[model samples]
Structure formats: C-alpha cells, structure tokens
Target: MTTLHTPRLTLRPITPDDLPRVLTYRNDPEVARYQAWALPATLDSVAGLVSDQPLGAPGWVQRAVTLRDGTVLGDVALNTQGPQAEVGVTLARSAQGHGYAHEALHALITHAFTDLGLHRVHASIDPRNTPVAVLLTRLGFRHEGTSLQSYRHRSEWTDDALYAVLAAEWTA
Candidate 1:
C-alpha cells in the first residue's frame, strides 16, 4: 500500500478499475511506439496485470499515476527487489509535457534511494524515446551505456539506452 504524492499527482497501486485508463494509452500506437508491450492490450489480460505491490518481493510493481481526485493519468513500475531498482513510466497523451511523469518518478526514485537504501536506480529505455532520455538526463541520471539490438519490439530489434543515478549522487 504505497501512495506517493507529488505537487500535481499521486502514485498508488493499480486496481481493476484502472485497467481501462491504462489500456487507453497503452494501446495507443504513438504512446506505445517505443515500449515493449504489444498494442491493443485487452481488459481481461490487463485486469489481472495489476500488481499487489508486495514490496521487497522479487519483481516489478505497477503503480497508478492519478490526480488527487483519482483521475488516472498514467502508470509507473518499479522493479523493487534488485540492488538497483529499475523504473518505467507511461502517461496519457493529455498528460504529457506537464511534468507529471517527472514528479511521480522523482518521488518514487527518492524513496528508492533514501527509504529503500538502494545503491542505484536505473532505467532501460528505447533510444527512440528522446523525451524520456532528456527527462532522465535532466534528473541527473548518467547515461551509462547503450546496447544495440538488445530489445525486441514487435518483430524488430531496438537499441536501449541505460541511465542511472547512484544513491551517493542523488541530491534530492
């Protein structure tokens, strides 16, 4: 039961009701362009995709990104069990360019570095996602490396850019 509040958004666990909201953007080709998952995410499959969170567990937890009034804006995921937690974010088209994603992710990453005592926090994003790459750079995450043809999306091989921030370097 983790709920993090930023100035304009709240990050909490996913519920069945959130599937439709998530599916809307998740199914959008423009939004899912550089993401790994396939398009047209079905309700049944998405409903069961909700994570119970279960912190300290060995996998990822998808959290709902919402407004104070509970309007779903997008979602974020954190792979909580590793030495360096990995994070990913998806925001509705309407919510983009508003800093909501940065706000939500900053809170979660702050927790990962401080409360969770993780040594580092990282993300592997498609190189084509320039916006996210810029966002990560602006957040002080170092561009660690790039792996070519490391990820398969649809039927094509894509390059991945690895960005990370060390706990010792996390000023926030």
Candidate 2:
C-alpha cells in the first residue's frame, strides 16, 4: 500500500474503517453536486466500492485524506491506465476552504509522477466547478479543453472540462 504524507495531511489507502466517513461526505448534497457517484450512498455500497479493488490493481484506487491527528477529511481517487491516469478528489463540506484538498492532491500527483512513474495524469470535471478548475490550474495542470453539453448529469446536459499534466511538466 502507498502512504504519502504532506506537511499537514496523510494520504493512505482507503480501508474498511473509512466507509462511514466516505459515505457521509459522498452523500452530502454539496459534496455530491459535481461528483459522479449515485445519490444516497450507503455504507454497504461504499464498502463494496472500496474493497473490491486492491491497491496495486489495474484500475481505480482510492486514498483516504486525513489530518495528522487522524481526522478524515475526504479522499483522493486515481484511475490508472498503463502510463497514464485520471484523478479526482473530494473533501467533506467542513473541510472545504481549508487548503486540505490542495495539499492532498499535490501529494497524490507528485507520487503519481515521481513514485508511480506515470507519463500523464488528467481530470475531467464539471465545467461549473470553478473551484476545482482553479485548483487544477494552481497544481500546474493545463486546461486542455471543454466538451460542451457532452453528457447528461443530474437531469441536465452539462459541460465537462479536461485538465492535464505530464510527468515532464510536473515540478514536484
């Protein structure tokens, strides 16, 4: 299992014990607003999602983002495909505006490029999520493009923005 540490946070593989906390934040309307997860996430469903995939397996892996004192803030998710990967992060409502997401994502991206030797990492986010767009920009990801009304989300056609960073472009 990969465990990464930032100055104030730790990114570790998600475990069974984190299901409830993950469920709680995942079900939060605000937190789920731009996320792709089904609504009303249950503990059993969360467990099934987190436990089915082993950490070093060939698909998605989730990491728990916690404070140094062991408080669960949220999670960072990476879906790897050969030398490239897609990434996402979620923070509890109370954890927003605290820079924890930035810190956690930095650690994850650095690990992806430096330790995992990924060629590229990217994210596709709802265009409406300005905060995430800014966060990605701050992390040195370039805005590749936006797909207009490419998919139906929450009963409406929504635009998706793609942002990416290459291993050679990553600074840390």
Candidate 3:
C-alpha cells in the first residue's frame, strides 16, 4: 500500500467509499469552473474515474486527500505515460485557503520525482485558473508556454497554460 502523509493530509488511493466526498468538490461549480470535466459529474462517472487507482498503478493514479480526522478534503491525480507525468489537484469548496492543497501537492511531487523516477512532472491548466497557476509557480514549476485555444473546457474553448519541473530541480 502506497500512502503519503504530509503535515496535515494523508494521500491514499481513492476508494468506492469516497464517492460522496469526492462528488462534493468535484461537482461544485466553483471547483469545476476551470476544470475540463463537465460540471455535475454523476456518481457513476466519478466512480469510474477512480476505479483504476490501485496504489502505484502507472496509468492515472488518483489519491484521496484527507485530513487527520479522515475527512475527505479533495484529491490529487497524476497521470504517467512513458518518462513524463502530469498532475492535477482539486479541493472542496469548504476546504479552500487552508494550505491543504499545498501540502498534498508537495508530497505528490516528491513521490513523482523520487519514488517513481520520472524525468519530468508537468501540469496543464485552463489559463483562467490563476490560483492553480500561482500554486504551481510557487512549487518551482516554470511556465513553459501557453497553448491557445487548445482545449475545450466545459462548453467552450479555452487556452491552456503549461508548466513543468525536472527531476533534478525537484531533488535539489
């Protein structure tokens, strides 16, 4: 079992029991505003989204971000393909601004660059998601570039912001 504990959160594979908690944040308009997934994601869809996360599985590894009291705050997802990986984070509306997202992201980045031996970790975000962009920058991810109108987010086309960090940069 691969589990990571930060100062305030435990990162573990998303389970079937986390449906409601996951949905609470994942379905919220505030959280889903800049996300690629359609808002009001159904329970069945959320279940399928996390069904393949088995510990250190190589495809899409999604971990439930939980507090010390076992309350699900949100989730962090990493997708690995070949030598590179991309990551994303989501937090409940009620859990924002607490540094929980920061803690969870730091732990996951460490795992990606150290435990997994990935060459580079990257993130792509809707250009309008300023908070996430700021968080990624603070974590030492350099803004690589922007892909204009490269993705269709929700019902409209949106630009994508690309950011990345190398393994050497992380281990330093």
| lDDT-sorted candidate list, best first | 2, 3, 1
Stretches > 4 Å off in candidate 3? 52-56
Deviating ranges (above 4 Å) for candidate 1: 54-56
State the TM-score for model 2: 0.94
Q: What does candidate 3's lDDT look like per residue over 58-142, in tens digits?
A: 7777888999888999998888888888999999988888888888999999998788888999999987889899899999999
Cα lDDT tens digits for candidate 1, 128-154? 899999999988899999999986788
Clashes of each: 0, 0, 0
lDDT accuracy of residue 149 in candidate 3: 91
lDDT of 2 by residue, 36-137 (tens): 877888877678555445333568888889999988899988888999999999999999999999999888888888888889999999988999999999
**What lDDT score is found at residue 26 in candidate 2?**
94
Using lDDT as the measure, name the better of candidate 1 and candidate 2.
2
True lDDT of residue 99, candidate 2: 96
**Residue 126 lDDT in candidate 2:** 96
